[model samples]
Target: MSEVVETTDCTNGTTTTYDVVVEDARIVTPNEVVRGSVAVDDGRIVAVETGEFDADGDTHIDADGRVLMPGLIDLHGDDIEQHLYPRSNAAVDPPMALASADRANISSGITTKFHAIAFEDNPEKDRSPELAMDLVESIRSNDSLLADHRIHARCEITDAPCIDAVEEVLVNDAASLVSVMSHVPGKGQFRNIEKFREYYENDANLSVEEADELIEERISLTEAELSTRIDRIVTAARDSGVVVASHDDETPVEVERLDDRGIDISEYPITLDAAQRARDLGMFTAMGAPNLVRGGSQWGNLATEEAIEEDVADALLADYHPPSLLAAPFVDTGETLSTRVARVTKNPADAVGLTDRGRVKEGARADLILVDPEPTPVVEHALVDGEPVYKAEAPR
Candidate 1:
């Protein structure tokens, strides 16, 4: 399954040849899966066809009939927080944490990642506006990362201080995606006050009374102020051509409001009704892959599998675990393998406005992963832009 293709190098005024050939791969695309080889030249997929081609190449990879699919496009994942703050009081340098996360992402078959950074003004949590801004800077300035890294600012609406920070990031062109979220006790992910209390106490080490007091203070803000700040943030993000998403939408009304504000994606809609309404309004709906793997949402919300069954979910996000992106397609989703794979690949890429990469097709970016799904799914090889970024060695 090797191919030889010819090309003309206009700048050099000479004819060139294919650089690499990935042979004998079970290439998985959005439409079908076929045993074939892929030809790459200058970091783009030049051809994908069955059978062997009598063409020479500079490098040859024996895919060995492994599943070669597009590298994952993760629209939302916060696993970097774990590497950044491995312990309660211990924190790693931002660049070091990001570099570690990049390796983990490429190892997990993620070629494009949007690191969800929460911008909250919580005194108890370390997710401050300054830290979020710093992460944006660190992710943008670093060029040695394996995966294509982008910032997805989780703008906590109640955190008034974060509004300016969001504006600044947009102005500086640092963030590629922005999602407006409100985690007050009575709504969104915290609709269950007791669950909210437990989470606050456990994460921030706050007493129940302290958590309640903080909730009360957060809810005390006037609706007018919150609405105004949200409008400003959304406007700025939209003006800057950043993809806008709504997080934890709980009702049709919420979905409609976000839709009216030009939100392109709805993340983690809490109820089936909300997800359905978001879909009806032409908004792409995303759910956590971890929820699908765990069989239920951790917070007793809408299950990911159920959402997919009901045709309310358009994409699956890694959420807190990068490995979940590749593992989710193997779950019992009651859908075709191609459909399941699209939830983590093509659908998310479309939702995030990335049109070039997500499928194994001709004239597309050569971001692909060779996976062995038997026993356990393992990323045997990961290629970003036709270059091998991660290659697993043979087991003993």
Candidate 2:
């Protein structure tokens, strides 16, 4: 996947003229929120200063005390799949789905979106592993898109063939982010077998008897097979320099084992102890933003609010909702605004080795969002590489 895009009509050294300038905004920096004006030229931030700029810009936006922060970088979101397969078997055209998902993410302030395509062997309607891999390739190759859409290959280690599928994507350079995951019942996110049954009942529309058969099949994978599969996938990810993350960490011991295996991130640790262990080991811990917005996890797991209060969470994933990721920073997590903002921006970017675009510093990529945070958090303007991708209409 390509990270750098062509800069257009950018500012030059001889002339301080900028392509765009945003004035009177509450800028969210790495450590503090300061009122300033930002000048963007040639897809990069050229100036950060207090108040308005004297130089001319192609366009000037009045931020009016609203938050001007780095656009949200969603590290793990399955919402693309939802857009693809809106109903059980009904499917939307891939191009249309991509367009819709891009608009949704851009409108919600997500400048970079990692579409989590599953490599798990799902036998449900329109939920085949083949479809997931196809979607990955499509998202990676599409050029006409708003958000920087990248592929996050979710490799279920329990399925040997799916693990191979993940390795293929890595070797082909189709996925930027790769995670080794296992959603088997009675462990990790599905520790309670009954909850797993309920999930499959709704997700796959399976009867209890069929769900029981699935449980048996999932648990039948030998420990040796699990180790071999995970080693293969993780090694391939490391060899390709792709960021490797572990999903649904269940225990402190599990977190430690994943950390030892060189996982850079822990996505949705099932227990606080697991999340704490990940942070202690210097691995970023990510939780679903929807979990925070909805007050708790849909399934019984670590509450995102508690994770933040405990200082174990480092980033928040949109997971399945773009609006949740946009509003999560303002959801009263009992933290400073700057601190909360980083969870959706700088932290996730740093996790995926995307350091240049996730912060609002001078010389960083001009990917930013302006938002009104009073009655509700709504994106007023969204820019990727200093070009306006989404802008709300002015009030009548």
Candidate 3:
């Protein structure tokens, strides 16, 4: 583990003041916030102090009395998939889709993102494995996007027939996080018949007749069948050393079973009990950023703010909206802006085992965002590892 180092050398000794100076901004770190000038050299924060200073750099940004903080680390988001297939029946260019997704990501100050691509074995949502593989290749090949994008594969274990697809993604090293999901209608997270009905019948763009058929298919799975598939996927996760997360756990019993399988992350535990169990078991608890932004869960599950208040939630993921990760908590929590920012930045980074980034501290990776805090606090600029990726247009 690389320890964080502090740098305090000033232009008092050398002719060069600093490589890059971000001044006139409110800087938010993990523990505190200060109106300061943050200097960057060799892509690491060198100094953070209040007061203007002469600086020399290939680039400089005047934050204009706005907020400067660590770029958000989004652990789960489906915005990329939405870009690839904007409409239910349409397919966009894979590379273009990724580029568009990255641009959207930066607009919200997310410097690092784990794109959760669902491996849907269901005929309606499953893209061809070849197409999925191509998209992953595009993301890896083109890393000069607005944010650092990694792959998080959502493997529907109940779709046991499609295990080959999951294995292929992992073997190709396209998957960074693996989540086991099951859509069996009668049980598991979607146990509420009305919730399942609303999702497939209306939200999924399926005709009522077609939705009925899909529901029937899901309801056909027996406990024995589901258990067998779960065992197989859990075994695969263990062997690969892939970070395994459980999705939408609703009960303590469900969390206990997930814990027994060596799961380290609990993605959206539906109930307070399940979330509490996850926290006690030392699993990283991830809630949707949208939930916090929207003020409640759309499906009537655990509210993100309530979860945070209870201290059951450890990380906030931008489940669908990338920007919500930047905006939601700021409004929900009464904490100083800096503290709200840490929940999205440092907290998630620490949970996912990416400690090098997240905080705006010396020796940390220069994944930072500078925003004008206007037009609903737009992301005026974005930087990753001291490299500029996006700069918003000047106001009219």
Candidate 4:
């Protein structure tokens, strides 16, 4: 946990004046939104009210009715390491990747993120096990990285060569979440052979001959062997006290099995049946916020907005896009913006067991964003742990 800052001076007999007073801001908490003033003493929220506030200190900001809420938490976004370093054959500077990704998250209002690094030892893809390890090492050593970056090891269960590498990540890095993804042929995400073929062919830039050979080579794991491997990984993860998530669960059976095995989060459940089952089993149904903002899934998975409207989905990941997290509320869900905003803020924090920082309340960490909302949604200011990390350039 980070230290909270404190100050002296208060309005209405409050104990101290806030370090900064965001006056007349549209404050959105989990319960409600208020047209009021927020008092920040040190780096904690000391006062939040709907009425007028007397001047306590010199520092103040006028939000002009833009939405003010907790910073968005991205549960599973691959925008950083994977997208930035697409080729295992090529090496990009790790510090550049970290700094660039942090700025990208700040622009998206994602103050906290679990940078998804897929565990793969393939020589063809640029993402070698060694490179992945280096990426984690580089980010963990740097304290000046913009967002509160955490790790999410997207462990590919079929990658036997990378099992030790996954274990290394768990032991060495701050892996907040571990997701089990099985991409073997005729199972998991590649359940349909044609669809699977299309994905590998079009997405991976693999020739038809190469794709066929790769599919044939994936036959090393028998069904029983695959099941055993998954169990071993899940057991190791649970023993380490890491949050475990099941990826792309496609059916009620899949949900039930994962739920029985103590999986706490379901990432992108492929069907309504699986999503609903996860919700009923007290597991969070993590959908892509991009799906909500885009009005549907990009590749035809379950739409997040529909799941939210139906009360089946509990949280949203930025998935591949960081900007979608902040843009999700403005997607016109017919409900008030306050209500829609909770899906990205309060719901996700709760889903991931982060209780103290999600709402604008007394004593909560001042993880906040000021949105400039006339021409576009611009993040005018951002704070993490009560310190201003991002402030927009003043107009000339």
* Cα TM-score of candidate 4: 0.90
lDDT of 3 by residue, 1-396 (tens): 122234344745555545567888888877787887788777788887776655645567777778889988998898887899898768888888998998898888888889887776544663545555677788889955868889887777656545667777777667778887887675656787767777777667677788778788877888677666667666776667667788999889889988887788999988899999999988989999889888899878899999988988777899889878888646747667766787788988886678999999998988888876655667887778877778885865
Q: After superposition, how far is residue 161 of candidate 3 from its true place, in Å?
A: 3.5
- Candidate 4 stretches with Cα past 4 Å from truth are 1-15, 56-59, 86-90, 374-376, 393-396
Clashes of each: 1, 1, 0, 6
Q: What C-alpha lDDT does candidate 4 achieve relative to the native structure?
A: 0.77
**Candidate 4 per-residue lDDT over residues 127-220, each given as its tens digit:** 5677777778877898987778888888877788667777767776457778888776676567777777787777666789988877887766
How many Å off is the CA of 284 in candidate 3?
A: 0.8
Residue-level lDDT of model 1, residues 1-396, one tens digit each, is 235566566667676588777899888888988898988887899989798744446767788888989999999999988888888668899999999999999988999999999998764667899988888889999999989999999999888889999999999888989999888888889887777888999988888889988889887988677778788988998789998898999989978977987888999999999999999999999999999988899888999989998999899999999888889987866677788888888989887778899988999898999899876678988888877779894764
The alpha-carbon deviation from the true structure for residue 94 of candidate 4, after best TM-score superposition, in angstroms, is: 0.9
The superposed Cα distance between candidate 1 and the true structure at residue 96, in angstroms, equals 0.7
Count residue pairs with overlapping backbones in model 2: 1
Q: How do all models score by TM-score?
A: 0.94, 0.94, 0.91, 0.90
| Model 2 residue 165 lDDT score | 82
